[model samples]
Target: MEETITPTRIFSRWRWLYRLILIGTVVLSSVIPVYAQSEPLRIHPALLTLAEESPNEIIRVIVQQNAQERISGGTLSRAGAQVTRELPIINGVVLELPARKVIDLARARGVRWITVDAPVIPAATPGSSCNMLTNPGFENGMTQWDDWENTLDKQISGHAHTGAFAVRLGQPSGAFSQSLQSATAGGTYTASGMFQRQSSNVRMSVGIDFFDSNWNEIDEVYTEIPPSDNYVPVSIAGVAPAGTVHMSIWVWKDPGGSLYLDDLRLHSSSMDSGACAGYPATAGYNVLANGDFEAGTTDWWLNNSSLQVTSTAYNGTKAIHLGQAAGSIAQSAGIALPGTLYTARGTFHRPIGAPWSGMGIDFFDVNWNEISDVYVTIPETSSYAPVTVSGIAPPGTVHMSVWIHKNSGSELYIDDVSLVGDEVPDAFVQSTGTNQLWHDAQPRTGQGITVAVVDSGIADHPDLNIAGSNNSRVLVSEDLTNSADKLKDAYGHGTHVAGIIGGNGSASNGIHRGIAPGVNLINMRISDGKGMTYASDLITGLQWLYEHQAQYNIRVVNISLNSTVPESYHTSPIAAAVELLWFKGMTVVVSAGNNGNGNGAVPLFSPANDPFVITVGATDDRGTGSLDDDVVATFSAYGTTIEGFAKPDLVAPGRNIVSLSAGNNATVTKEHPSHKVGSQYFRMSGTSMSAPVVSGVVALLLQDEPNLTPDQVKYR
Candidate 1:
């Protein structure tokens, strides 16, 4: 107690310690950065990607309970967004909001930001798209796929080569394939699939099937899938047919077989996804499981139950030998899509020349409709010849019947059989204006959506790079006009519009191109050669497009016309039709008119004046790529219509745009001879050009956001 009474001495010592602590605090504060202490943005990672890639793009979003009210009040209502979906569960709403407003929604009251409605797949490799196969890895366990008729032995198990599960083909299985609806014919492609088998008794193979427009087999190539302890890989490289429209993958396993397959991938050299990056070649399967007939006639069925599965090998350990007169054997093929090409090849051995009436393969549809004039045969001879059946698959063909006619007691042998297919190639580097915008934007190229071009007509060209037997041009065509065929482009304007929207630039060495190069096109010819279009013809065309939108996966329609007489969309038939399309979940893009902006007076026209559609105006991007000096085109119409709604929902480049040319186009030839870029391309201007550019961007938007409504597209 007596020592504590010395207060002045203790205070002096405590002051020194306090001064030292203050100095240390100042020193530490100077070393640390303010950002290091700040909290990170509390947004989903994928949502953040939205901000970076497609800021103006509107998308669906899910929120927490009671968050709809706050989100709509704070973000949707303020931004004039329309709700795509409003779910009562968890009080959720799938709304299409501008990508920029995502953060605002995150900050709103009572708004707990759940993730995006769909998984935001990261942008793919700059030039490559995502895998196009459905149920590719058997993860969904036999969904969206078809197997052999003898499917009783196939098993879906967890022993996957890649993914959660794979289908195991055990003892008595034929080819397993899914119809490739979107395959591009004439494109170079590579295919690889994994297989696993611990035993040596089973035979495995892989192959590529070439199919024509009628699903007929054009040509085929087969390779063996090797065996492995875990999983082996097999692959084939080839070019698809110019007439081939689609294809199918065939996985075959020999009778009494046991193998597992997973991670089947088809890499397209045309789309620039050709690299296999350490793809396995050993222990992989082939296109034909028992192409050599070494598997003892397990997959080959006896039509008459009189054929012998003999060990009389023809370049193999086993072959099929006829046991009785008129005896036959056949094997079923994998189901193929319409317009695919395939080929069947085998060696027929005949030790004794017999009077066999017929020995060839027959094609049939799923309904068992046998096709005529599409088979290969061996004539009466003791010597053998390599027989081949190569032709376009007839329409509705699902199976190929290969059989031998054992006439006059002919002892025949068949061995070393195989089939393969492939696709054509397309070069994107020929496309001009394909710059950082596409690279930095969301990774999609209007792959799934289709655009309807309502104009004069569309012509087929290499620039279009269309898929299938059609060569990527004109999937569907309607000649609403009386002057020409569905594929005729009398005025050339329609072809120019189509080229700007989806030209892959096969003709221009990749110079002139469209926005969504991979998107499909539907041509609705509604005008005459002199560029004359009537309201009746236009309406009829629009009606046809609307009725068959589902058939073509039509998500967008492009109208580059104008109406001189202004009327409210509420009363106009054409405008009403546009509204119907919008309501039916399609984005209708119309030109904002090239009527000189009506001097800011009567600037609106027909369908473009409608409030529900996406009206596009034109901006001159100069001769350069930068937008720094961009200005609204003098001829691009803009202003409030009589209905009291201002328009030009979006603006895009329209000046001096180079696109596909309808050869010998009267209007183009007379008006713009000097603007030609190449044999297939010509330059044009106006809101007509701008409208298609916007339509293309809409396709890209729909690629990743397919659920977006027309109002959503307009708002975006």
Candidate 2:
């Protein structure tokens, strides 16, 4: 190593070995081993480093089936070679040394070079891909930033090839299209995006266009976008063209303006679907406890004394218990009271042993005196029948007891005991009219006449019996209350009214016969004696009479009770309905109330002030003379509306008009002996006693001419 040698001799001795060693180093540096690493693969940085380090190295790329294509560009210059070229890298294939490798070899020969990963491809689905065709770089050869339009152009140019195309426009207009790799046929398609206009004064129309393979326009739809800060969802559904086609979004300006489009999507049809089916029935409760007496096991019988408790199968073949004992048994139980009248009703099954045995229920006052009694006698043959007893109670708490007295060992069954009282009729005993109408008119049977009786209720008194004729045709009968039972009177007002209208001279051993014994009677009970009825209820009663006018041969409706206008009257639906009834041909008679003269106080209340109704005033039965008989009663209200109209059309006899009361052949003593007529009658006063007098006259007129309208009847 210390020996000196010539430069020529040393170069000749080691040149070949040195050349082989350098080649080996280059080859080793260029080659790289394929190995899995924890780090994620990044192709751009790795490829750039390799290009810079070993210029002569052969570069290859391997990709998945759907991997993106890439492009690389570089410049090279050597003593004997100079090259500048850009090459495309196709994905999904292994590539050997390509034509661009020449630049790497040139760089190995000591040429200056520059390389770049070019042609940035946009991310896309396999069926649809994108690539940049060209890059203009910058305008004016300056590297300054561009506006939104130029930026968009750059982004579009970066991914314009391979069936994916984009473009930028300062303004959107007409229709635009781009080719698609594949198309759908007879499938639902949807496209959506956001569109905005720059000028507040301008409107923009955005739409999607579909084209066939031949570039023929197939379908298009347009939606409007206002020039405001709002993102509108514009979508369309239709069948896609067959084979490869194009889809485009376009916007047209009404007045040239700027517009924006973003967040675009497209989809197709999926599958058919449905939901569960069938109609379901509504559910409700049977309501077992709907006010059926089901408390204690005493069989709903209250025994206040020693008595024998027994059960009987009667109405509906249901068992009803009866408590029977001898010495004046008295007991009470809670019962339903409706409209002031107490009615005890039950069905009796035939006795098992003795037939002549009678079973009776006694209704007692608080002092334990019998007020009303219902009794039934069983025949030898076992039979089922109904027994009913109805009368007035003492208004408050009282006692009711059922009993059976056995002349022999006989059994009786009772069922369906019902008690109802509230708004019961006031007890009105009929006074026989002294002077009768001497007009030679055939006794009217009340077929064509309607006589509205404003009172408590009417009883089936024989002399005042205007219910059914000998031909069995009931002239009129209906409960004015909102209930079904029509035969019971709570306070005897009906019996008195009927007597005044048509009592047939039969009651309490012959005392009172009505004014017109031939007139048909309509028992319009408007009071329960304790208080006045609500205006709404009274209006309902009047409307009912009007509705049944033709059916019941009714021509007039009499409302003798009075009440202040309800708060609901000014806008009452019931009052409006009543007005409609009056308009449609019917005369309404209303009482001019009992309130006397007062400032700003009108005599008549509604149906009376109801404009078209015939308002009646009351007069005492004093004079048998001419117009002097028309003087209003002292208690009667004088008519003059707040707006001023002469009311109280005419006066009729209302004071001490004798009528009938409910009683059998026995004569009963009067509570006020001075008011008693002979032995079987009593006298009372009030407009309640006057209404039927006019109702009777109307009945007489109807009997004379059957076709009289209520107006005509009123005039007569």
Give candidate 1's total backbone clashes.
55
* Model 1 agreement with the true structure over 408-439: per-residue lDDT tens digits: 46577777776533211111111224433456
lDDT for position 126 in model 2: 11
- What lDDT does model 1 reach? 0.61
Off by over 4 Å in 1: 1-434, 437-443, 467-470, 484-487, 597-599
lDDT agreement with native, every candidate:
0.61, 0.41
- TM-scores for all predictions: 0.39, 0.34
Candidate 2 regions exceeding 4 Å error are 1-448, 466-476, 480-487, 508-511, 524-526, 529-532, 566-579, 597-602, 623-631, 662-680
Q: Write the per-residue lDDT of candidate 2 for residues 122-185, one digit (tens) a residue.
A: 0001111011001112111111222322222111211111111222224433332223444444
Residue 588 miss distance in model 2 (angstroms): 2.2
